[model samples]
Target: MTSLPVIDIDPFGTEVLTDPYPLERALLDAGPLSYLSAHGIYAVARYDAVYAALRNWQGFQSGAGVGLSNFRTEKPWRQLSIVVEADPPHHDAPRRVLANLLGPRAQRRLRAEWMAKAHKMVGKVLDGTPGSTVEFDAVTAIAEKFPPRAVGDALGLPEEGRENLLPFSDFLLNAFGPRNELVAAGAPHAKFLTTWVMEHCRRDALTEDGLGGQIWAAADRGEITHEQAPGVVRSLFAAGFNTTVHALAAVMHALVTHPEQWARLRAEPSLARIAFDEAVRWASPVQTFFRTAVGDVPVGDHVVPDGAKVLMFLGAANRDPRRWADPEKFDLSRDPSGHVGFGFGLHQCVGQNLARLEAECLITALAERVETLELAAPGERRLNNTLRAWHSIPVRARLA
Candidate 1:
């Protein structure tokens, strides 16, 4: 049997968190499973290995918590996500409620309304630009603005305190990493955000037709325990907003940097969905998730010991050369179906349809109105433990 390759690198250090590709390459080159001695964790970067771990939930469990701190041993900063942080039996009910509530059929009711909202938002953005060639921060003016208004409305969150959503989401994603400065800085706001989220998730606070109300409705029907309902709502609150926002920013960054691809998208607007998926594959928004080994699980030539934390590098797996041709290049033509950008298997993003729909609406609206999209300046990165997002993506758009 081959011995595990032990690497001395801080996976949560600011350097790797800021720009992780070099470390990702090193992990992949080392082998399917490498031990990160800096953190005492096992890491997997290859697509095949990561995918296998994600799909084998019984072997690689989520109940331990999807971050560096295992729930079995240490207490989480907050209550664990019922869906993203649990395995079968316990995960099934909430997952079913959300999957059905946010599923394709449920999204159809939202599609027309969201598309109209996207067009209106795009028009407003273009109007505010001040010239035929208008320069603006795409992250703030476009990506950040759209998802909250659209999905927030859908979730029936109150209009007041909506500004707090993104910051809270950032804090939540950061907590998934180790107790670093990023997490430390956001810690103060965690209580306020938690209170706000919990208060709003109450059955009275949500509109009857909105997604949050629907989860409560499920609890009413006893599909899920009443105690489980708020956590389910919190799950959506935590996972839904920031991911779509960052994903939008990623797609915009990908398109503007690659003009030919932008032109292709404009020419064939139907490719918006595929473009979003490719962008996600190219610039993974949610980077890494830790899965605990249920028992001695054989990975490649070695076995991960029971109760050990195994980190799956979603971003690295998305670009694995073995799984994708020209993996580094962002191409809409590539079928990014098997990509782990939204993760794989049971814990795959339940809100993916809603996310894809949001992306399709926003990208299609932009493709229709903008003739050319180009970066006005180098974009700044938003450093977080889990997300690869932009602080600002300055761009100049030529109106069609």
Candidate 2:
């Protein structure tokens, strides 16, 4: 067995949590695969190893959960995610249910409605704020409103419960990290999220317009039993909303910092879709996911013991110099679809199309209306165990 390179990633230190990108780049440069005892996991930083782990689910089972430990061995904050954390046969059902809900035809149906909503929202955001400094986080604030309402409406959640979307979704996503202040602070909302989702599955809470209603509809036909339908709605709240919200923030941050890129985007607004993909590759909102080794597995000359935790660094892999030319440069011309910002193979993000549509709508709206969008103040990065995010970004935009 080849000796693994060792690096310490002490979570207690703010450095690792705040900007693991530099550490990731260092690890990738040292070797494609390494071990970090301080983080208490084996790290796969290069594109090849990360891609292999994502593809070979049998070698790195999903039933173990996609966080720092095995769900079978260590209980997750909630029950394991059916789509994001489960493996085959068992993983197939929920994924199919969501695929149908968010399929191409459904996305097509959503595109025009969402674009119009985005335009209205951006119009309000840009209104009276032109030439005045407005925090771009407000744009994210404006942007975050759409997904949950859209997902809630699609899922059949009531109009009254829509306010629970952002707070609940934040708790759900934060729960993936180690039990810390962040997770503890979100407890009340997380509890509400659990109760709301489970109760909605009980058959009375759903409305005809949302997919929550559709899940119950499926349950009536025995396509999905009564037990699984609410979990599906919960999945939408947890997985669907938070990811898209932060992803939009990332793109906004990138465009603000990179003026030339913003100018190019303003000139060719049709490139909005690709800009979102590039932001995914660049910021990599979903930073890392852990995989548990099914057995002794050999990857890139090193052997990981059975049941060991393997951390797939999606952020690192996306910026890996070996696979991506000028990896650090945010080029709109680059083909970023191959990047693992959305995992790969069977476990790839099921809501990616919906996310792309939402992001595209917002980006295009901004590009069309703003002649120039630049940072008003330096941005701050929020540190989470699993997500790379921008906490605050103030901007000055010249609205057309």
Candidate 3:
């Protein structure tokens, strides 16, 4: 083929991570597929192209690895996630097992229990004693705390080493991109955190009553190989934790920043799911996921060479005007159903139902109590190659 547009942006640089929307907007303005000269990888940011690429898995596959370092060549930093890093045949069984285990029906048991826990948790945080104000960092207070407790209890993971989940997940997502400072900083601790995660995934480490045990039960049913069971369990925190926690933080930030949306949610608590999805679309918390080109694939206008790494900017596409009107605005009234906040197609987030349920429960409790939520100070971003995290978001929630 001929040539495509070239953008000189370092897709993972500190500048873009601080405020990514402008560079992302330029990506949309640049044709469908543009070469990031800084990284030497082709980039896709348009909504239609990204939406199509996610579906045409055979053409742009994840099996080679969903990171910059292709598994076909380099060894992965950790054991490959059968669910996140595999293609059809190998992916088939693990996907089915996770689908069966993590889906809404399987997680239905946690609905009422988690909801009750959330009410108690929020009540404690913003104890409404007539006319007093309660303030806390939503990141540490709710987002970071909820997932591990809910998921850990569900998986029967011991309470002792649960702190490792966040850093472990950060390292894993960073490993997907270039070995930059972010990944390097976590290198020393990777061994310990990774060891903790692997240990927890074991059938022996899990309680027979939780979902981790359910994975072993799937192993027994011939759904997956016995050896593959723990890795599948690993997928729970690997794919599920960082994404859900960060998204929760992002959505809470959105609601606090957009008082109208919070008011609407307070008036009609059922819009919790809608607000969550909208925040995801607006924030694009889980930023980039890579797919290697299988062959000479036609992406947008250019034919990419065989084995070229195609970096899909999910954050950019979520805000593409072609897909969303006034995409920058976090509007609860907006329908964010097709948003790539949770990827797309068969590889779509398997734990989405769980994430949605978490948001619903937490938001329901907050809506019932908090009269007005306002930012106590400017929020800080926890920059990572793949995740958009909040280091701290100070907010004061007043109860009427």
lDDT of each: 0.91, 0.78, 0.88
Ranking by lDDT: 1, 3, 2
Model 1 TM: 0.98
Give the alpha carbon lDDT tens digit for every residue of 263-345 in model 3.
Answer: 88899989999999998999988999999998899986697778889999999999999989998899988899999989998
Q: For residues 31-125, write the lDDT of model 2, one tens digit per residue.
A: 86788877667888899888988888889887887776567676565677766777788777777877887889889898888888889888877
Winning candidate number (lDDT): 1
Question: Is 1 or 3 the stronger prediction by lDDT?
Answer: 1
Off by over 4 Å in 2: 11-13, 75-77, 129-140
* Clash count (model 1, backbone only): 0
Per-candidate clash tally: 0, 7, 0
- On TM-score, the stronger of 1 and 2 is 1
TM-scores for every candidate against the unseen true structure: 0.98, 0.93, 0.98
lDDT score, candidate 3? 0.88
Taking every candidate in turn, the Cα RMSD to the unseen true structure, in Å, is: 1.3, 2.2, 1.2
lDDT for 393 in candidate 3 is 97
